[model samples]
Target chain A: MASPPTPLRAPEHQVAGHQAAEGRLGPLVDGAGLFFKPLQGDGRGDDEVSFYTLLSSLPSSSLPSSSFFPSFHGTRLLPASDGSGPHPHLALEDLVAEFSNPAIVDIKIGSRTWYPQASEDYIRKCFEKDQRTTSASLGFRISGIQIRDGSGAWKPDRGEIRRFSPRDVRIALRRFVSSDPRSDPDRALAAAVYGGADGVLAKLGELKRWFEEQTLFHFNSVSVLVVYERDAGATLGKGKVKVKLVDFAHVVEGKGVIDHNFLGGLCSLIRFISDVLTGLDENCI
Target chain B: MASPPTPLRAPEHQVAGHQAAEGRLGPLVDGAGLFFKPLQGDGRGDDEVSFYTLLSSLPSSSLPSSSFFPSFHGTRLLPASDGSGPHPHLALEDLVAEFSNPAIVDIKIGSRTWYPQASEDYIRKCFEKDQRTTSASLGFRISGIQIRDGSGAWKPDRGEIRRFSPRDVRIALRRFVSSDPRSDPDRALAAAVYGGADGVLAKLGELKRWFEEQTLFHFNSVSVLVVYERDAGATLGKGKVKVKLVDFAHVVEGKGVIDHNFLGGLCSLIRFISDVLTGLDENCI
Candidate 1:
C-alpha cells in the first residue's frame, strides 16, 4: 500500500552547471521522508556510490557519527517522474522534510577541488574555477542558497552564489538567518542559530574537530549543506539546525596523512561564521 | 573487604599558597582508581559540595557529558592517611591513575576569579592576584604543572608556574608535552598531544562549544586539568590525553547568561595550544 513517488517540490540546491535538465526526473520524495536522487551515470556517481558503500561497511566507531551525513538508504532502480524506464537513484533521508519553511545553503569547502589523480585538463578547469570564485581567497564558496521570507515564500539565489565576493558571501550568510532576507537581519534568531549549542557554527565546529583527527578519507570538493527551519521560534530548539557533509565524489583515501586541505577549508568556514556571529553581537549592543 | 587507603605518592598540584603541611592528609588514592580530595572547611568547600550535588541531581542531558569532569562519587567522611579522625572528602575519579608516568598541568581559567557576591576585600585580593599573574593578560594562569622526565621521575613546578609570563606559560605548555622537558621540544609528541584527535586541544574545543551555548552555570575560577601519559608511544592512542574541568568552588548559576569569562579564557588557551602545534609543525618542516 505505498503510493507512487512525486517530484520534489522544494528547491533542489544543486552544484553550479549540474542542474538536471528541465522535464527530466530530478529528485523525488515520498511520504516517508525518503529522497531519491537520480544517478548522473558519470564517473562521479560511481565514486559516490562506492564511498557510501564503504562508509556503510566501516565500523560506526571509525567513521564520523552517522548524523554528519544524509543517512544512506541504498541505491535503487526507480521510475522517473515522467514514468520513463527505471533508472538507478540514491535513496537518502530527506533532511528538510520536517521543516515547514527551511532555509538552506550549500557551501563548497576547499581551495582546490581537484584531486592528485585528476587529469591536467581537469586540474586546469578546477584551478580556473577556484580563482574565479571566492574559494581561492576564502577556502569556501556558497554554491546555492534559498531562504524563506516572513510570508513563508522561498527566495533562492542559485547561479550567482558561486560568483559571490567575500563581502557578498558574508551578507548572504547574514541574510540566510534573517527573518526576512529582503530586510534587516534578525539579531536574536541569528544569535540562536549561529551561536546556539546546536547551531550551524557549533555543528561545523564538531565536523572540524572530526576532520582534524580523522585519517580515513580525504574529502575533496565536498559541500557542507546547512539547513535550518527559518520559521522556528527565536529559541531554536535542539536539532533545529542541520549541517551535513555532502558531495563526496572526489573523496580519496587518507593513506595515514591528515587531510590538511579539507581541515583548512573547514576552519576557514568556521572563522566566517564566527565573524558573522560577532558582528551580530556587536550590532545588538 | 576492601583494603585501607594509601597516601597519594604523586606530586599534589595545589593552588598557590594552599599546599597542605608535610604531615597532613592532602589527598588519598585507593586501588579502585578513586582520588580522595580532603575538603577545606572554608566556604569554598561548601560551595563545591553544593555544585557537585547540583550537578549530580541535574539530568545528564542538561549538562555537558560527565567525561568533561571527574566523575563525582559523592562526598563522604573518610579517615585520614595517618589513621587520624575521619574528615569530609570529595571522592572523584583519579584522572591520572592509569598512567605509569603522567604529565599534569592545572590551568586556572577566567580573567577574574571573584564573583559579584564576594566581599570588597576578597575582590581586591583576587584582583591583585589576577593582575600579578597571566590571568589578566591571557585569561588563564598555570596554577601548577608536573612533567615526568626520562627517568620516570616527576619534575614538579608548582609555585613558579603561577608566576609564569605569557611567553613562559607557552614554554611551560610546550614542555608539558615534550618527552624530555629538560631538552628540546619533542615535535612528534607535541603534535600528537596538541593536535591529535583525542588530544588536549580537541577536548578543549568540545568544552568550548558547550560553554558557548549552555546557560546552566557560570564557571568561575575553574581549573582545566590537562593530563597525558608522557611515555605513550609516538601515536598516542585514544584516551591517552585527558582534559577535565575541576575546582567548582567558585561556580555560579548561569542565570540564562553565557559565561563569557570562562569562554574567553578557554578560547585564549586554545589559541595558545594551537600556536604551539603550529610552531612544532614548522620546526619539523
Candidate 2:
C-alpha cells in the first residue's frame, strides 16, 4: 500500500487558550481508563471543519493547547490549505496515494485493523491491556487462515478489520436467519466466524433477540463465551442469551459474536449510554 | 443425605445492629448487607460461613452496606446471580430425595457434580450475568449427553448459588482439579459436587497439585473447564471443547457443560492455579 498523506490537526496554541477559559471535569477516562478519539468528517478543502470535529470529540470543557501534539496537527492530521508546521507539506498526489494505501491501515491476522500498523509487539500489548481501549486504538482482528481458494495457491485469509463507527458495529451483529447475501451477513458470518456450528449460533441469536424484544428491561440470562481463533490465537468472544423458556432448568441459546457485547443494564446507565451507545471512544479488548 | 440439621444461623437482630458498625462504607441496605454469625469462639456453634465470607470479601470501604448483597461489588455486573438473593434456596437433603435417595451430588456425568434439584433458572442467571460482567461465566455450563446417569436419572445442577468470598469463588472453580480425597465430603462427592468431564474428577488432584506452586499472580492464565448438568432442554453446552478440538470450523455436537475459553491470559491462570492450589471457592460461577 502507498504511504499516507501529511495528516491535519488543530493548532496546539489555539486549543491551550480555550482550556484557560473553561475548566474540564473529572478524569475524562473511566475507572480503568485509557487515552481516547472521534470519527473524522469528509476530508475536503475545509480543514477547519475537520479540525473542529476532532476537537469536539475530545473530553474537555475547554479547547486543548492549540498544539494538539508537540509539532503536528493542522499540517498533518487534516492537512491545512497553507503549509505551516513540520514535514514538507504533502502534495495532492501524496494525499491521494496515502488515502488509497492499505499500508495506511495495517491489518493484523484475524482481520484486525491498525491505523499506522499493528506489529506483533503491538498485538502483545493489547493482550496485556485486557480491555477495549487498546482494541479501539487498533481495529478489529481478522484471522489470517491458510486457505486454498479457487486457485490452488496458498493465501492469507482476506477478511478485513476496519475501524468502524459504533453504528457499524451494531449493524454487523444484527441479522436474518437464512443464507441471504447482503440482507444479513451476521448469520452467514456466524458460520464462517465460528466455523460451522449449526445450532449453537442459531439458538444464541433467537434467544438474545427475544429477551431484547420481550421480557422488557435488561435480560434475565446472558452467556459470553471467549473462544480464541485456533490458528492465529486471536482472542474472540461468543455471547448467548439463555432465557428461562419455561421451568427453572430449561433455557435457549442465542447468537454469537467475535466482538461480543452490549446488553441490558450491564453497566451504570450513565457509563453505558455515554461510552457504549455513543462511539466516543473505540470499544476494544 | 437425610435432612441435615438446618444449619444454624445467627439471630437477625444481633447481626443487623453489628452490620453497619463493621466499617463497611457503601450505601447500607439495613436488611440488605449485614449477616448473622454466632461468634466463632462464643460456643453458640454455627457453620454458616458462606454468607459472611461472601460479605467480608467486598472492598472494605463498601463492606458495611455491601454484605447484604454479597454479590454486588457494583462494578461491571453480568446479568443476575443464580442464588445471591431472592432466588429459592435448596438443601442437600432435598437434592438427595430428588435424586432417588442416592446422594445426588454423587451422580456423575462426564466428570461433574450436579444437584438436579437445583434450579436451571438459577444456573442460567449465573451464566448470563457472568458474561455481562466479565464474560467467563459460561465456564459453568455442563454437557447434555450425560446429564442423566447410566440408567438415565436427572441431576440437580446447583447445590447452592449463594455468593461466595473471592477466596471461596476461586477455590470452587479450582475444586477437585486435584486434591487429596481426605475425608472432606466436598472431595468425595464425585460428580455430585464438581461436574466435569466424567472421569476428569478422578484426575482433579493432579491438575491442581501441579499448578498450585506456580500460580503466583493474575497473569498465570490458568483455568479449569468442568462440565455441568442442565435441564431436559435440547442443550446445556456439553462436550463443546472436545467437539471444537475435532475441527475448529466444525460446530460442537452434544449436550451439557463445556469450556470454550482462550488459554492465553486469565483463562490460563485459572487452570494453572487450580492445578496447583487449594482452599478456593466451591460455587464460583
Candidate 3:
C-alpha cells in the first residue's frame, strides 16, 4: 500500500448512476454534485470533520433552513490500484452535479488564513511577504477542472474560472438585461442569480447578516464557494444555484470580538461582489 | 469582616457626589447609570470579574460603543473599621448616578437560570419541574426595595416589583395616553422610554437583532435592566433612558445552536415588555 495518499478514484460503492454511452459527465446525482478537497497533512481535517458533525446535529429550526452546506458521508481508505496499502481520504457530497452550467467560485474571507498557526515560521512568513494581498489576487489561479462522466468515468471540464469583478459583473448583467432571454440563455441565467440591482443587493445584505449572526462562525478565515449553473435547455431566466462554506480548520469556540482586519476584509469582498451584480443590473436594463 | 457580603455602602474612596444634607438620592453621575445585584454564593462572583475584564479589553469599535454594559471598577478587600479583618466585594460603577431620576427595571431573559449547571442537583430539580412558567411568575417576587437616599447612602428600596403582563402594559399605556404629563410625572417618564407605540416596537426589533448578533451572549439567562429618568423640568415628554445587560455567571463558550425553548421564551418576554412600552406611548399622547 502507498504510505502517503493517492488521488480520488471513482467511488467503490456502486449505484445505478449515469450510463457511459452518452459521452456526457454521465448520469449524476440530481444537481451539479462534486466534492474535491486537498488532503490534510496535519490535523486541520479533523476540525472540518467535527464542524460537519456539529452542523448535522443542529435542530432544523435553528437557522432559516436551506441546503446551505454540502452533506458529509464518511472517510474511505483506498488501496492503490497497484495494490499498495490503504490510504485515508474523505468522502464529501459532490455539489457540482447539482448544476448544469456549474460555474463555481471560491472566495476566501479574512486576513489571517490560518489561526493557531500551523507553525510560527509559517505565520511569520505570511506577514513578512504580504501573502494576504497576493492570496486575494490569486483568485484567478483555479481553472475549472474535469468532473466525473457517465459510467463513473472522470473527464476534464471545459468551464473556465471567470472573474466577476464589479466591471465584469456589470457587463454580464447589462448584456443579460439587454439581450432577449430567448436568445441568450447564459446571460439570462447569470442575471437570474445576480438579481437586478436592488434584488441582488438585498440578497447580499441577507448573506452578510447570515455570516454575522451565525453562532458557530468563529473561524479566523473561511472560504465560501458559490456554485451556480445555467441550463440552456431550461427556462431562460431561471438558473440553479447553491452556496457552500468550506475550510473549517480554524473554527473556534464561542463568539469573541471579530478582528477588525478580518471583518473589514470580508465586508469589502462581499461589497465587491454586490457591486458587480448591481452594475450588471443597472447597465443591462 | 462579615462572612457573607453586606449591602453596598458609600465608597471608602470619596468623590464629590451627593452631599447627604437633604434626604434625597443626591447628585449622581449623568447617563443612565445603575448597578444593583444580589450577592452570589459559590464563587460565581469570579465570573463577573472575568466578564468585566473581557468587556474592558474590547476595542471601542465593537458593539456600537454605547454604555450597553455597566462599567466595572476593581474589586476590593475592605477591612471593617472595627478591625474585623477584610472581606472581598466588587466595586461597580453606580448606575443610579447615571440618571437624574434613575428608575431601573431589571428584566431577565431565558427559561434556564443556570448554564453548565451550577449545581447538578439543582439542575435535576429544574428539569423535574417545569420551572419556565414558574420563572415568568417569579418576576413579581422582587420587591421594588428602597434604593439610595441623600448622601449616596444605600437604603432598602420601597418600590414594589411591578409585573407588566401584556394586558397590564396595555392598561398602563391607556392611562398614560389619557393622562396629562404635567400632572403625572411617572406616567410621562414611562411614556418617554416607550417612545410611543410605533417607536417602541421599532426599538424592540433592533434590540432583538442586537441580542441575536452578540456572539458573547451565551448566558443561560440574561437580565436586561432599563434605566430611565424623566427630566420633569425639561419638557413634558422628554426622558433619559439606557439599557444594560447583566449577570455573567452562566456565560458559556462559543456559539452553538441556541435552545429553542430559551429563544422562544426570550422573544415572549421582550414582546411583553415592548407591548407595555407601546401602551404607555400610545396612551400618553
| Residue range B1-285, candidate 1, lDDT tens digits | 133356444335333324445666676667457877777776877888889888888887886663787888877687765457887877878777788767788888876676666787987799679778977556688887877656654445565665688777777788777767767756557777878677888889888778766657878788998877766453467888888888888888855445656765676678678867878333312
TM-score of chain B of each: 0.88, 0.21, 0.61
Chain B TM-score, candidate 3?
0.61
Which lDDT tens digits does candidate 3 get at residues B205-277? 5555544334344555556555544333434332255555666666664232223223333444443445454
Q: By summed lDDT, which 10 consecutive residues of candidate 2 chain A come out lowest?
A: A241-250
Instruction: Please report the candidate that would top TM-score against the real structure.
Output: 1
Q: Residue-pair clashes per candidate, as listed?
A: 0, 111, 49
TM-scores for all predictions: 0.50, 0.22, 0.41
| Candidate closer to the true structure by TM-score (higher is better), 1 or 3 | 1
lDDT of 1 by residue, A215-266 (tens): 5787889999888776655446788788988877788886433455566567
Residue A44 of model 1: what lDDT?
74
DockQ of each: 0.02, 0.02, 0.02
Candidate 2 residue A93 C-alpha distance from true site, Å: 26
Task: Score chain A of each prediction against the true chain A by TM-score and list the results.
Answer: 0.88, 0.18, 0.61
Among all candidates shown, the one with the greatest lDDT: 1
List per-prediction Cα lDDT, in the order shown.
0.71, 0.24, 0.42
Writing each residue's lDDT as its tens digit, candidate 2 over B1-285 gives 121123323222211112223332111222323222212222211222332243346455532211112122212111112222221111211111112112111111111111122257754564344433223322222211112333443322232322333233343333422222112324433333334552333344333232122211111111233333322332323321111000011112111111112211122233323332332323222
- When sorted by lDDT, best at the front, the candidate numbers are 1, 3, 2
